[model samples]
Target chain A: MLIGRPSDITASEITPATVFRKRRALIKAAGLGTMMAWSGLSLGEEPKTKIQDYSKSSYGQEEKLTSYRDITTYNNFYEFGTGKEQPAENVGQFKTTPWTVSIEGEVLKPRKLGIEELMKLAPLEERIYRMRCVEGWSMVIPWVGIPLSSLVKLAQPTGNAKFVELISAADPATMPGVRAPILDWPYVEALRLDEAMHSLTILAVGLYGEILPAQNGAPVRLVVPWKYGFKGGKSIVRIRFVEKMPQTTWMRAAPREYGFYANVNPTVDHPRWSQASERRIGGNVFSRRTPTLMFNGYADQVAQLYAGMDLRKHF
Target chain B: MAPTSIAWIKRGIFLLALGPLIRLFWLGFTDQLGANPVEFIEHSTGTWALVALLLSLAVTPLRLLFNMGWLVSLRRMLGLFMFFYACLHFLAYLWLDHWFDWAGIGADIIKHPYVLVGFLALILSIPLAVTSTDAMIRKLKRRWKTLHLLAYPVAILGVLHYLWLVKKDISQPLIYALILFILLLIRLYYRLKLRRV
Candidate 1:
């Protein structure tokens, strides 16, 4: 379930940011997991995430990365569990060392390739993007990955291929969260053919220059900066090209709340919460509730994708 | 009319009622209030409010079933505490979430049933808390008990508020609902017994 956002932080007497940082350093020295306790103080810990090694990059922006702790600890990976911390606590046991992703469906050449083989398909670059959650919280993340188009182009989609379905690997024993009837097991997400080939879409392998943490979809995950964060399928094991639009987990669970495009449209409010404003992670708890931007501040890059369509009804 | 023994028991109950507030402060001071501090505080206060309401409602049934007449002494404090925390929960919504966007909140009340029910539960509780004073209780006399009967419906609304709030996984709210059902059954059982006589 999507958790509630920052509430009543204005009057809160939380420790001052300077004092809180001193304690965080102490906690870190003591080898304690005080990340959640004072995560707000660490949001600005890594602000110099400007990557200099991009063979092919566009829309580069200077942004502050969420505290590594908050980014890693607060997750929505239900395959590990529903609670935000559950993924960080449980995903450590997940094996990403020997990872493989099979690219199949409506393609000239279908093949199963290891993680190493996939990484070599295109030049890797770092893209810092703003990820808005459907739950009214947002984050700025610097992702190390390559354009997903690099891989899709290699698979060689046939003329019939118009949509793409991504399946995240979920075994009952390994992903015990699936044992419970929370969401359909082996989480699935879809992208329109044009959307899949967009410059903004990529397959992420790491964050903050480090290999992706298990909780943050280690090995490989999809990053569509314009869409809500949930649309980014994590720990992907299968990529299939389909003719018709494919069904996604959140869209199937609550179609009214989630949509196929799942674009970060502030105008289309979610049934449960308004999407107009979002509290950025890592800022002082109260002063950070800023108005959410259309397509999460990426309208200039991707607005032409939906020129004349009604986002509200399709939302 | 209060005996020394009952007075001592009342003090114990009064202090016990302060436990949630004290615990919250301790957690806050120690920096232990998890990732979203405001949400954590909101949930904790809301949960305690519901628990207090259920406990206060249980007083009457326990008095008759176990012949423990002294339980009534604890009822007023428990009920007042429920109102206190309910106010905190609503404040969290207004201040933390909406930032005093009255027009926005008013629209929310119209669109979302959970917000409507929760707002109703909080509003209905105000009069009950104001009238809880011993002076008001004595002055109002027979009219007091009738007005206080509003507690039952208020409890029902609270349970419903919780039921609609969660998007999925209703386990936490289910326990509260079951207890409320049992309390209602006990009241009905007593009414039938009196009618038989």
Candidate 2:
């Protein structure tokens, strides 16, 4: 049996050509009107904020993308709620417009950029990346965003900067989950400076060629393909460059179960579940488990980022 | 109560116990099991098993509290339902979740504490399920009661399995834990009062 092979994904084809064409048309016609029509609709019929004019990247172009419906509904955005379906159901009232992200700490240029300014930092690219969750499920999603390196370079971080800490919005007025103390408030995640600047790392503003739904981290969120899904903090409010590794929310919650670098390692088992194999989300119940890959099948591109470090120790 | 009414009540409880399984099949056939159907099936079966097990444990305390001796007759049926759902839960995990990979299943049972506890609870319940028949109960009247004491441990193990399985949100499992605690406390209270008498 070929375990963790790229061919595991090849068995399924990408979303059909006609749907792709319709998506392209939708992207072309996206405007301020679509943004206004984004509220009070069920996830099945939710009008997505269609992203305009993003260049398609070479990453995972041949892979089958998870359906837009599944991607929008099945999420781990704990700010909205912890249940997979709760985020979509509870996100109707969340307001993402007029958003601002403060970029500071150890950077020569400290400034607060509005959501639009962040999107304009560099040309957005649609990169289909395989996302593996710590709960042993995986999905291939086409995310539209600027590379994290572009924004970090723009910030002009000083030599003292060693790590980047990303913080998610946690307003009790808007987010119901924040009322209960799940994992300390304002979900925080961090990455090493090198990892943040890697080409594979991006701040995703949209997915499936649509402006990100509130459930799927609308406006802007980090997307680190090789790491577990939680590494990507959603609906981010602040990006701070720090000299020391920031204590991430999950790490603080359970230091033994979650680690600083949540890289997708099949050999390393989670305390409660196996990390060796993942159920591809879009398939039916009969779909056989697909073996998880080393660095989630991007080993060649990202292996050098942690050459000498022990993944088992870090994970 | 009259025998016919008692029979009707048992029938009602029986159908009520089957509701979750019927709903599962209905959802499965209608293609509404959601994104991760294997997990959905596994979760549904496991939760039903826990619910039935807790209900079975509640029979005695409820009977005493309400002064209704007839509730004792329903205990076996509730217990059998618990076993039935537990079997389905294990089958789903073994077949749907792991696809009959014995090595993987075996390793999971041995490696994770939650899996091990769940497996142990299922294994221990087998004898209670088999000896539930009237003939077996009559043959070993005194021994039968001792053997059925396994239910307490099984309930404890089931709750532990759930408590350990959750990632961070212990809310669901904590509710189960609270229910189990209250039931056990009621039994303890009765035992102490009987000893004093």
Off by over 4 Å in 2: A1-44
Reference-based lDDT, residue B171, model 1: 73
State the lDDT of candidate 1 residue by residue for B80-160, as single tens digits: 989988988888778876788888889888777877887888888888999999899999999999998889889999999
All models, DockQ values? 0.21, 0.49
Q: Please, what are the lDDT tens digits per residue for candidate 2 over residues B55-105?
A: 999999998789888888889999999999999999999999999999999
Interface RMSD of each: 5.0, 5.0
Candidates in order have lDDT scores of 0.81, 0.89
Q: Which digits, one per residue and each the tens of the lDDT, describe model 1 over residues A22-136?
A: 7766787877676554454333222222334444344446777676666776788888888777776666357887999999999999999899888778787878888888877
Q: For residues A238-273, what per-residue lDDT tens digits would candidate 2 score against the true structure?
A: 999999989999999999999999999999999887
What tier of docking accuracy does candidate 2 attain? Answer: medium
Cα DockQ of the candidate 2 complex? 0.49
How displaced is residue A226 in candidate 1, in Å?
1.5
Worst 10 contiguous positions by lDDT, candidate 2 chain A: A5-14
